[model samples]
Target chain A: MGVDERRQQLIGVALELFSRRSPDEVSIDEIASAAGISRPLVYHYFPGKISLYEAALQRASDDLASRFVEPPEGPLGARLLRVMRRFFDFVDDHGPGFAALMRGGPAVGSSTTNALVDGVRQAAYLQMLSHLKIEDPPARLELVIRSWISLVESTALIWLDGRRIPRAELEVQLVHDFAALAAVSAAYDQEMAEVLRQGLKDEPGEGPFSDLVVRLVALASPPAV
Target chain B: MGVDERRQQLIGVALELFSRRSPDEVSIDEIASAAGISRPLVYHYFPGKISLYEAALQRASDDLASRFVEPPEGPLGARLLRVMRRFFDFVDDHGPGFAALMRGGPAVGSSTTNALVDGVRQAAYLQMLSHLKIEDPPARLELVIRSWISLVESTALIWLDGRRIPRAELEVQLVHDFAALAAVSAAYDQEMAEVLRQGLKDEPGEGPFSDLVVRLVALASPPAV
Candidate 1:
């Protein structure tokens, strides 16, 4: 293989291992042996274990960010469900690595790792904004959107830790959490109210978003005046 | 100081340090000096750094659990607000240690630290259950309550990570989260609906819970039939 191809191959092998366990738990010798390459070659491709780990982590972040990019051609609810399905799928496949990344401190929380992770968040946030068809949202809208992202991360971490709820239920709950948060935000901010109204109108009337909106509208009074 | 008092004092001193940095970052000698004691004396009370760290962790855990213990004398909303306020206070006071504990599974993932952490959750859960006056809740209610706990924990973790939202706003949002989750559960489960109705009745109509209930009922279709 060409040098580039060789580097890609090594990173692929290391990503699989990282997904299975933390970088600290894996070793250069083990990675090289798993790749059918010599230890010196592993070092040749990557200067050290830390560099290799960074490459592997960046690869995972890229994969996860790509997963969050929803198709821009459906009802908002359907698009969200599709996006969530992809997210949950990633969680299922990379449960250990995903947990380690999200928990993120003293474990996988180096400045370099945190920046890579934040890049993923920024990507996901932009994707959600595009899906919602909202650009240049108000501060409250922005906060609500970011909080939903945070909520999803937390929910995913906890869900991975314990499969107390089924996959479908988890998906429904997470989607609802976004809508519910938007609804709550709308109650507090007029701009958010309009954004939520538009987002819901973009969704099918009978799906989870509508149902959640219906319930939240029932709980909260008329949109913030 | 007497032996028991000395142990408590040493643990308190260690907790202050732990609150400033991760347990792994704090050393036995530093802890001893910080405590105004000799290294051997520090070992005389606790076997080693891990033991001292564990003791500090347990102390913080116990303090958190105790904070969750509201008077249970007011409306559920008031009680919840009080408990949440205390929770945020703990986070503020022990930001580093709290972050370390919440970002579990590597740094604080040892069985002992986990058990102590789990004990805090159990205590908080029991405290909420006792306040709600529920002896044996159904699976659905139990799940709702436990998920709220998880949400609070995640919110705390994220809040510490970024103080984007004001402390009062964060507290209010968390309190509303518990109410919102419970409201959603009540809409689906008749048993939960009754529990919510009864719980809301205990709060003053002018308070937040009553207002939340009033708005939810308006959206949800009349006290869930």
Candidate 2:
């Protein structure tokens, strides 16, 4: 394999192994053996295990963050559900690594790792704002969106640990959460109220939201008339 | 100090030290010196460094969890603000230790520590259910409350890392989130709808909730009358 291809292959091996075992528990020889490469080759690609682990984490975070972006082609609710579906899928595909990344601990407390994880969240935040066609949300609205993302992150972290609620319900519940937050903000922040008004008006009647739409429309009390 | 007093005192010293540095970086001699005692004296109270660390962690988790409780009084929103204030205070006071405990990295990944952390979350969960006056909330309501608590926990975790929102506003925002979740759940679940009805009806026209109540009361659209 070429140098770049070899690097990518090694990272994939590390990610697969790291998912099942903590980094400290995994050895350089083990990684090399997994790849049928010499230990020197692993070191040539990554100066040390820490560097390799960082690469793996960055790759994981990048992949997860990119999944949050959705084409602005559908209704806002439908658009958000698409983003959420991708998010849940990432959590499903990488249950262990994603859990450790989201649940940062002494093992992953470096500044770089924190930034990588925060990048994913920041990307998710920007995607939601983009969906709302918002440039700068008021602090309450910003907090509302950030808190909702946190809710999704925390809930996803716990769900990966043990499957309590199934994925389909989890998706709708998250979509409903964004709508509820928008309505709640509308009650407090006028700007958000208008944002909610514009966003929900275009909610498509053809998706999984058909059932939840009635209650959601009711949440926007005073009819926004 | 007597033996029991010495044990508690030593644990307190260790907790302070662990808060400053990760467990692996902390040493027995440092804890002993901080306590102005010999290493043997430290070992006398706790078998080893890990035992002392575990004890310190337990003490911190127990203290943090106890802070979540508040007297069941006047209004649901009012009672919740009281609980939230206590929750934020724990985060403020025990920022680092609280961070470590909640993060649950390799340093403190013992099953017992996990149980201790979960216990706190459960206590907070039960307290909110109590304020709702519902002994057995429906599954949806349970998930709703649990998700909100998770939001509070995740938000507080990030806030400690950096103080973007003031503690006071964060507390009110969290209180507002619970109300919003209650309102959202009500629209679909009949039990939650009634719970929202009774809770809002009793929300006092006083305290921090005064402004938010105007928005929340409007959330129970169609007047639930």
Candidate 3:
């Protein structure tokens, strides 16, 4: 294989091992063995374990960030739900690695690793703003978006603890969470209200926002016997 | 001063200093100077700077955990708003320390420090459960509450970066965020619905939950053109 192809192959192999166990626990020998390459060959491709681990992390981070991408073609709720689906797909696929990276496990102390994680969050934030089609969001709107992004991150972290909640439900619930956050902000600031208005303009009766309205209106009435 | 009084005084001085500047920047000499004691005398009380830092951190952590304490007498929204106020008060007062602790700065790495931070989050969780009058929350209810707690944490961290939004508004908005979270969960799960019902039982129209409802209902109508 060419140098570039060998590097990509090694990164893929390292990410797979790191996903199952922490990078710290996985040895260079094991990575080479998995790649069917000699340990010396592994060293030739990368300087050491930390460098290889970082390369793997960079790959995973890019993949994770890309999961937030969605074409701004449908209702905002539908678009967000699709994003959540892909987001959770990454979490579900890369459980231990995702948890370790977010929790800052021992093997991941470099500023480069930190930047990779931050890059994912930044990409997610910009993707969200793109969905909102706002080059410059109002402060409250920005807070709402940033808070929702953090919520998604934490939700994924907590959900990984025991896999207690069903993944599908959490995906839909998170999209609803974004709506709920936006709704609360809209209620307070007129700018947020206008943003929510534009977001919901194309939403269908079966969209997440409508589902939230239906659910909330049910809450307004007396509880059923 | 007696030995115990001296230690307490030292911890107090260290925390005050740490609160203003990152603990990594504050030296033992400064801590001694601030406490009106000699550098050698500072070591006489504690082994070294790290131990003194931990002692100070323990005090701050205990105080932070205590801020979550609230009587269960008032409306849930009002009670939660009060809790948010105190939470933000800690964040506001200990700006540098709070940011450092949350962001995991160079000064903090030991498992003990991690435990202290976790202690604060765990204390806040129990306080919330106590206010809900729940001995054991159902799964969905627990998810909503935990997610809300994370929201509060991130909000404080983000708010600290730049105090662009008004502090009072963010505090109240957080209470609304909790209501919004539980509202979304209630719409999905009967258990959460019942939980939210009990929470809103004594809430007045001006309560955060009611305010959220009023705002959400307004969104159901056409925007004011």
Candidate 4:
């Protein structure tokens, strides 16, 4: 096999082992044996077990990101619905790999692996934000972004558990829920923005956490807002 | 330690190990060593590693059930808000154990541990149903229940990840989201209930995956409904 082919094969075998057992449970020797390759060959393609796991995880994360990161052309809500549908479809098709990433596969534990996933997640969040036309304070916008991310991740996990519900129907409900949450958060963001614009100085009235909340919110949105 | 005390200690130590590494990585010897007991004594409390792991898992499941199962008397939305608050608080306080249960710890595979978690989750679902005054058909009620569960679980996981927001703020937003979802589902349930009550003859034209939607909705209510 070519170098890339051999590398792909190793990741496939590693993922199979990871799905069947925890990352720590499977040994490099066993992975090598199962792949029908010498241990040193396995080492040549990847530095070690952790490296192999990171490769697999990055592949899955990238696949998901590539599939869902397009900017929606029409209404923001419609675009979001499309994104939700794509995500649900990905989880259904790639159950084991998605499960491993979500369940914190060895790759997710490493700072490098986490950075990749976090990068994708942030990119997706920015895409969602790009579709919004809300005039809200920065703090409220951050909450909206965080809430939307949570909703998608949480919904996907439940669907993966194989509840008796059909995938299509669940997706519809999720899309609706996402719309409702966005509406509420948008309203709250506007309220906060107005408060800040009015020069409601952080006085002794609000408490220390109030400033923290304002700062976090400011960090979440575009500079123009 | 007495047999029961020793068993509890073993389970505790096993859970700690399971938290750090998958079940297969931690041997009975390691658990015994950590607990300052003999391997034979550890085996004496439980037959093998799997049994010990299950025992620890069951204990964690029981702890969550005990904390959230007993409903406070009030409107369905209010009761649900209270439950959501307590649930988030429990998870925040017992981060490792709860995270393991939700995300599937190393002691067992995702499938097995998820089934255990599902059992506790179903019980909680039933408890939530006890609070609702469903005016919908049995099937529609089930969908509402499933949707509500989805909303709460998704919101909680977001908080669990320790994002920028404080837990208290997340908890408050969750309660609001829960109420909004419950209100929407409750309305949908009533609409479906009315349709069913008028007999299947006058049923509205079915949409894509409507039957599955109806089934999921009904799964949340009492079987008799």
**Top candidate (DockQ):** 3
lDDT of 3 at B145: 80
Best by lDDT: 3
Report lDDT per candidate: 0.76, 0.76, 0.86, 0.59
On residues B69-91, what C-alpha lDDT tens digit does candidate 4 reach at each position? Answer: 65444334345446767777666
Interface RMSD of each: 4.8, 4.2, 1.7, 12.0
Tens digit per residue, CA lDDT, model 4, A123-192: 7666655555333426445555655575566566666665545666556556556544543443334554
Task: For candidate 3, give the lDDT.
Answer: 0.86
Encode model 3's per-residue lDDT on B148-217: one tens digit a residue.
8889988988899889998999999999888888888889888788888888889987766766777778
lDDT of 1 by residue, A1-225 (tens): 999999999999988988888666888999999999999999988998878888988888899999988778868877888888999998888888877766554446566877797798889989989988888876656666666777677667767766765777767776777776666555555577668767876666688766865664554343345
RMSD of each: 5.8, 5.7, 2.0, 13.4
Off by over 4 Å in 3: A1-3, B38-41, B44-48
Docking class of 3: medium
* TM-score for candidate 3: 0.94
Point to the candidate with the largest TM-score: 3
TM-score of each: 0.76, 0.75, 0.94, 0.58
Ten-residue region with minimum lDDT total, candidate 2 chain B: B216-225
* Selected candidate, larger DockQ, 1 vs 4: 1
